[model samples]
Target: MGEVKDVPLLSELLKDSPKNWGKWGADDEVGSLNYLTSLEVIRGVGMVRSGKVFTLQVPMGAPEGDPIWPGRRTAQRVNVMDHSHYQCGKGPHFPGELHYADDMMIMYLQGSTQYDALGHVWYDDQIYNGFEAETTTGGMTKASVLPIAEKGVVGRGVLIDMARYRLKNVLDRGETFDHEDLMAAAAQQGVEIKKHDILIIRTGFIGSFYTMPSDNFYDNFVEPGLTYSPELVSWFKDMEIPNLVTDTIANEVTIDPVSGIALPLHSALMRNLGVAFTEITILDELADDCAADGQWAFLYVAAPLKVVGGSGAPVNPVVIK
Candidate 1:
């Protein structure tokens, strides 16, 4: 088989795709998140009926290890100081005989449930808002996650459980879905995907990662996700979706089957339409509750850590029904 570098470039695949560059302004780093105004927050609040809550972050340092992108490792937490240290007379002792435990984590910013910076992906030597890609050198001077973390994401969220809709516990590897499929799943759940809604899709992919053997899960790893197409790109533009949260590592298929390009939607949507992307989320609990209550819409609130110059930041998104 031919190598990945032989495929068409992302710029070529998304050549005519719609772009929201300078839509908010040249200085805007948060991109489509600007759609989440107070009015949208009010709209989100209206969806809270029973007041059940769900937190959508996967445990970092899980015993089974995290399901991360191939080249990256799971988060590793180390105890800087603990009871063991105190017992060994190695830990600092505060006045009044106070003792405390401390810890630190080593991880890729995108290792867990996280929000990707607008500058996370790009092509043609440019990032979102037409910022020169060179600005990303040394540490995201243009569209880092800091701006997004400060603004925050709060709005209506709709869950489209594609696995349940397709009568599968988990989608087959490389399975693909598109905008029409999303609408169909929403229709099945009796919900409408409105403008500025935080679109959260559950493929049951992450849930499988915990049960299946790690080697099997990573072998020929192609995640089932939204495929790239001009029409699908247009739909995202028309819908004005602020954020896309999914149970997969990459928000879309790892490699576009048709174009043989990797993550074309990252360019067509995030880098062009300026939509926010949240990946590696724990959505089974949220999806189960939504399925049980027949209520798919809810208030989605997330604040990624304000890591300056970070390409992305971990987030524990909260969903209120």
Candidate 2:
């Protein structure tokens, strides 16, 4: 919520932004999520004037097709009882009907709409708050996704709506925007990025994909996202925003310009800053609703699956205006 002033670029801030290793504590697991205090939740609740809810999750099997991520299988669902078995009264005991539809699913938790827990990424053999990498290989003993799932993420959610404001719903693949762009868009929308807010950026990626669904296109092609810049990281740290969700696979540009690291922003946020991220979120409906009503900030409610010791989990986040 501070004024936008000139500051060192990401490259410089990357060297200076102190690691939040022990800011919360050496044993801290939830990372920046600690920012979501009860008062913050109360602030979010007060924003819900219309009581309209918008779910921000893309379906588990999205685009009406095969899996988009390579090597990850599509979500599988199977009935526990077949038609023949159910008809023969082989199902569990019941008075009138002896049949029931019981089903199970085998899914890749991070395949669709998901949250990248603090344990999901690391750098220099360290995770958030200096947890070792070896411990995370088997399963994260520290900073596991369970804690986040158990303690729901609730706060004021703000949508940047970059696609509609800047690209006119035609964002190009591999295009990247930086901190200035984010601030400019927010200013244009008359929305301020508040502390401890769940910041959601709409790049129009998910919206575009729905129109032309292609596994190959999504899996291999470049995509538009926030540029992996130190300036952007600095802004996040300065703003104290806890969670970030975007309509892109990777929150940052696919290729880093300076270090050439594949996902430098992930390392900066998850590894260095303890900030959580959600990717491939469905934000078109939220964007449209915000544009129609001019209410950009609202109450955000998201609960990650309580997958014990898991790196990440699928999430269904809802925004209420």
On TM-score, the leading prediction is 1
Segments of candidate 2 deviating more than 4 angstroms: 1-17, 66-68, 82-84
- Residue lDDT tens for model 1, 103-185: 99999999999999999999999999999999989899989999999999999999999999999988989999999999999
Q: Which stretches of candidate 1 lie over 4 Å from their true place?
A: 1-6
Model 2, 3-101: lDDT tens digits are 234333344446665567899888888888889999999999999998998987777653375323446776777668666676786767779865656
List the lowest-lDDT window of 10 residues for candidate 1.
1-10
User: Which 10 consecutive positions of candidate 2 have the poorest summed lDDT?
Assistant: 1-10
Which pairs of residues collide in model 1? none
Model 2 whole-model lDDT (C-alpha atoms): 0.79
- Model 1's C-alpha root-mean-square deviation from the true structure amounts to 1.2
lDDT of each: 0.92, 0.79
CA RMSD per model (angstroms): 1.2, 5.6
What is the C-alpha local distance difference test score of candidate 1? Answer: 0.92
Q: Provide the TM-score for each candidate, comma-separated.
A: 0.98, 0.90
